[model samples]
Target: MTLSTRPPAVRTSLPARMAGRLTRLTWIDLVVAAAVLVVLYVILRVGAGTAVSFNPARVTRVSTDPADLPYYAARSLLRMFAALALSVAFTLVYAYAAARSRRLERVLIPALDILQSVPVLGFLSVAVTGFIALFPGSSLGPECASVFAIFTSQAWNMTFGFYHSLVTLPRELDELSRSFGFTRWMRFWKVELPSGAIGLVWNGMMSFGGGWFFLVASEAISVSGHRYALPGIGSYAGTAIAEGDLGGVGWAVLTMAVMVVGVNFVFWRPLTAWVEKFKNEQSEATDVQRSLVLDFLRRSHWPHALGRLARPAAEVLGRAARILGTDDRPLSVDPVRRRGGDAVFALVAGGLIGWGLLDLLGYLRDRTGLGVFAEPLLLGLATLARVVVVVAVATAVWVPVGVRIGFSPRLARIAQPLVQVLAGFPANFLFPLATWFFLRTGLSINVGGMMLMALGAQWYILFNTIAGAMAVPADLREAMDDLGVTGRLRWKRLILPGIFPAYVTGGITASGGAWNASIVSEIVTFGGTTLTATGLGAYVAHATERGDYPHLIAGVAVMSLYVVGLNRLLWRPLYRLAETRYAL
Candidate 1:
């Protein structure tokens, strides 16, 4: 009767069907996209470093006037976030590769250990020259170099966190993916990513914090006796430090406080809340993570519109991905065949490593002689002592505080913003005043340097603890409650076990951070005076400042050795224990 009234419905053509199915741009989506485009346009036009002629002699005009601090702060944040984006990209790829195969993991983990230990200055030594050459005559060259240096500070921690997540992925999630016949892309997109999301977010925050820690060094790049200071809060603060302007430093701190608050509200809070749903909680979490920004955005249609727009590209990539890896199938290989292949690979890799070591030894012996190794080894020991002290102190102070904050949603809401701000409070911010105070008190550099190192590395511990505590299953907590577990008993059984893997991840990065930070922390400057501790960091800094490449290489080499050895001997074992014994 309806068809008769409508004079018979005509069959839709393919094009007509497609047109009907197409997503029409909603008003809200258009509004959101327009706003986003405007902000992007602004970011590209000016905030993305000005392109200037490649001048190796260009000296940045760092103005310390409070009037100029806002723009300077904005520039610094732009560089930071740019680097953060790159770091995330690098982490996804690198950590995935390292996690996928045992053979690769063997090499990659050690390489990563050394990489994270390489100080920011070590990166600048090569990055500045290389990037400048690459861009030829663009301000973007040095800006890229600065961003890359910040990336060096941020990427490794994120990579390690992601790698840990991949390796420690629960057995059930993997089985679920396989049972559903998910393609590799689907598995990674749906199961693996969600499982890792919590750790990755927290680690990303720590990585951001590390970027802020090294901002001064990253922005104030020195190569071949020429200083290329970029227009940033770091550069502004450096100028203030050079002039002994405590007021200027104070102003920089104030600006950073404001910036941190804004970043927390705009970026991190939304991310935290968004990741909360991805969390693998066993029973309903009554204390939900919430963000006003996330809530507001959920009310808008932009994200869905964007997702729809991206669907075609995603489908193409998914097909490409399926060609390489199995569609969530259990990979069965002949053990003998795999072993044979692995052995051949190992032999070739071993040969290359041996050759490289021999070459390095030859070069070092010809220049500084074999005896050059002795001093750095001793200095590395000194630095190691300081690292131990710093980690111990940090673990003692922050574990309870972080755990308490994590378990209490109300406290977490209040404390997270503060921690985010404080975590990013660059240790260098205190160098002028703290250095002055230390000098005034006539304290040993060992005492003062340990304190400064703690300022940088302790946040790693705190961040991981909170992430770990939040991840504890609600059902487990309920069970503990039913069993009348209290205080130490609760901590010993559930809390400690739940948090162990995360703590190990944090500890590894924190330890590495301390080693990396020693390059800045062990060498303090105030006005025209420089105070140096008798440690590998001081040696590396002294070498870099004076253009002594041979000693610099030796100092860096020894430091890497220390880091890699410590990781292989201590951290890696603990990591394995965490994976096996404590993993959810």
Candidate 2:
């Protein structure tokens, strides 16, 4: 109409406009955003209540309202996450130290072994007193103590995982890193960390499972005449059991189950899937795990936005690190100076050890005679016997089953969560029920305790075996199939050798956990009745309750000795054998 010189009006198409808008929003995006908001609200609510007075007098006076369950759970989760963060940091430093220095490794590795073998209850006893004194008159003190206890339960295995990974890194990769002239810091972040990620994640998951078994004991602490009932699911369960409230117990169990599932979905699944990138054996055709949450994060604009926000701080950190970093060139020190330093270190260490031995001897002589150690030693032997039987039985039962499940990817996907849930279930929760049955049926406490230990420890063997089987090389599997390997011969020649290393790792963890669980399992209480078995765990628990510090220390020391001895003599040898003969 008009052949007017004016240009036609530019218009945007509806589909194009809609597509632009859709790029900013997906179904997963909305879901994740909503989840974030809810989590933030819960965190704020929990943080608000954390301002309570640190009155030791009020530690035992805790609320048991069902409506407070969510708040309590949030608190417990905060404590656990805090402890886990600390554990991860500790593992990185401790493992790096051990891996980088042969001199330190000799001391550090054995020290870690002893530390891990120390039962959680033993740590709780010492930690509670010290933390309370440090934060006198504040709830924060006991809270810190509880977190420390959980940390002890979680840190050791993760440390071992990282250390083992670092030490076992392929020689080719090590040489490559060195040839590239990577600085120490760069090598750690780029090479060592990635190489160890898979083991660290798996062991971290196992550590979390182990932490749950001690959560109740940590939260509802009653040692050295100090009773603290922290507001958490653990304390809720304890209160429920004390009052015989079946409904409360059911509620607590349901809440715990929900929490475990949520963690698996939101944290572990994503982590496990993400760490596949770090696997040394990953091939182009390897079907890595997929997680919807991880996928959403990867695909969404949120990651880009977060990266942009963090870039400035990261750049600052990088600059500072580079400024302070040492050169990669090897340093040549005078032989005389090096020898002097080594001599000084040796003398200091010897002096400390000698002083400790003298102090320990004097304390034992004055407070508790040497003869008094005989009872706990005998009790330790009894516990050791039970651990041996339980581990043997668990290995027999779970090895074949785990191998079978591992062979089926679909079955493994299903069984993994189930096993995790089972592992997370606190053995103490079953004590009241088991105690009732044993009391009614007149079953021996020793037998019941052994069974309970098995229940607590079997998951380690099963999970490790499953992982070992699943990790079997696809080429090896194909070769076996082509060779027509089957039946007992297949298991004897292929399966056992393939999983031997993993089996040794699992057995060590399971044995340690069994010893720890004995503190709870060897002593069961239902109402006014208490059933105790003659074992080191029972000895420690009784002494702790009585506030008998001397015996408590002695019992813990004895238990530690046994654990260290067995690990050094038995597990260490087996591990070395596996590494030399069976490792892929």
Candidate 3:
């Protein structure tokens, strides 16, 4: 009865305060931050000390010692990051342009399908010489070539991801942005980007994995009798395989694993966690991922100080954007001008196609003889059959598992990084191992090659399905549970439909990746032993090795046609069905 009518004074225990501070200093956080700083220092030191002498004669110089692993890894990472940065920028621009223009979308989507199907080896064969010549007399030339090759490996799928996300933005939000009179730039930055952020981040991660998948071919390139070996883990691994040094290969694999783990900690994990804020769906089941490095950065006083230092530069950029930004208003174009532009575009495209066709036919008739084309066509059909079978198998296996793991936040958190690292394990590096096993077991190259292709491509389906499943709304699950929806009925009625869009996305990318992987998988070699499967991939690889440009071009063209045709005839229809029938 005698308690004063005033509030009690708040008190904080010293132990509690100490515990609060300690919570900010996790072991994982400290270790990641320290390792990252050390990596950056080494990268900068190596980059600066290494001159950019574009001497073609010096391009062959590379270290194979185990001690050089760290430096090589650092160099490889720099190229990867450079390629990734370029890929992101290309995605933003290309996806936006395609999304905004119906005319462009008609041409661009099919172009992308064909481009993605063009083997990485094809890019290496065609682009290496051009890139080297672009910066003649400088080491930056070959470096640029390698980075560009990785960029080709990484960019197409990410562009598709962003474009798909943009096209699939919720109708209500699209209308809202339009009603708010958002400018083109403002709409992109706020609406399109944030709407697409989740897919873009996931696909970006996959793109990086794809880059690593082809890193060896890109780094240790031999095109048109010109060999260039850029010092990197990829080159190290390639050399090990070439020398038949199993121990060296093991060491290279270990080094790659370390690099992948470090990359996940420093880049993907933090980015994945941070981009969760951009998700448009408000679902209790959609738990934002946590990253130790992100937590450390947020808690560290230096980052805040650095932000303050960067404020002026950011403001300048903001001002420049505002000043340069165009209005979002739609203009009524003159029909005459529009028709004229369309006609010109059509005429130029027709001429180019005609010329290309003529050249291809001439080469086929004169160099390859028309009779030889049948062989590749038959081989391509076999490869296509293998791709279809492998994709179906992967879908059957991964869909349910991914869905279950995704539904559990704890499990998803645990699995995401592990899967990311596994996906980044260059599938080609294991080719030698597979070859050895196949030789011992006397397995058919076709069967073994399909397995390798599946191993390389199935992660696309797995990871994307996990992402889709995790995004499922908590209320939907709860409602299904309350309604006693379980077993086949639950999946058929709720779960499968919920994840259909993601499954289609994964399926499309996986199929394309499988086609690309066929090039390496079908033509396996370890030291003196070479295993060649009867497929278009092996044909391309053989042609590449022999510097037979006409056959190589023919094989790549046929593969691109098959890929684009399949996407148009199969995947595109399925994608439409997903968007129209099952989109969440």
TM-score of each: 0.94, 0.89, 0.88
**RMSD to the hidden true structure, all candidates:** 3.0, 5.4, 6.1
**Candidate 3: misplaced stretches above 4 Å?**
1-40, 49-62, 283-287, 301-325, 331-348, 363-366, 369-372
Segments in model 1 whose C-alpha atoms lie over 4 Å from true places:
1-35, 325-330
User: Candidate 1's residue-wise lDDT over 1-584, tens digit each?
Assistant: 34455566799999987686456645655666787898687677556455866577667678888998877887898899999999999999999889987789878988999999888888888888888899887888889999999999999989998999898899999998888878888878888888989889999998998899999998887766878888899888888887898899899899988888889888898898788787786678888778887887787767776799999998888987777655544567689988998999899999999999999899989998989989999989999999988888888899889889878777887998999989998888888877878879999887798888887899999999998888777778888889999999888999899988888889999999999899888988878888788799988887887777778889889999999898889899999999999889
lDDT for each candidate structure: 0.86, 0.80, 0.82
Per-residue CA lDDT of model 3 for 214-300, tens digit only, reads 898888887766678888899998888888888888889999988888888878888877876775554554455788878877766
Candidate 2: C-alpha lDDT: 0.80
- Clashing residue pairs in candidate 2 (N, C-alpha, C atoms within 3 angstroms): 54-137, 54-138, 54-139
Evaluation by lDDT, superior candidate among 1 and 3: 1
Relative to the unseen true structure, what is the Cα RMSD of model 2? 5.4
Task: Kindly indicate the candidate among 1 and 3 with the higher TM-score.
Answer: 1
Model 2, runs deviating above 4 Å = 1-27, 285-287, 304-344, 405-407, 486-494
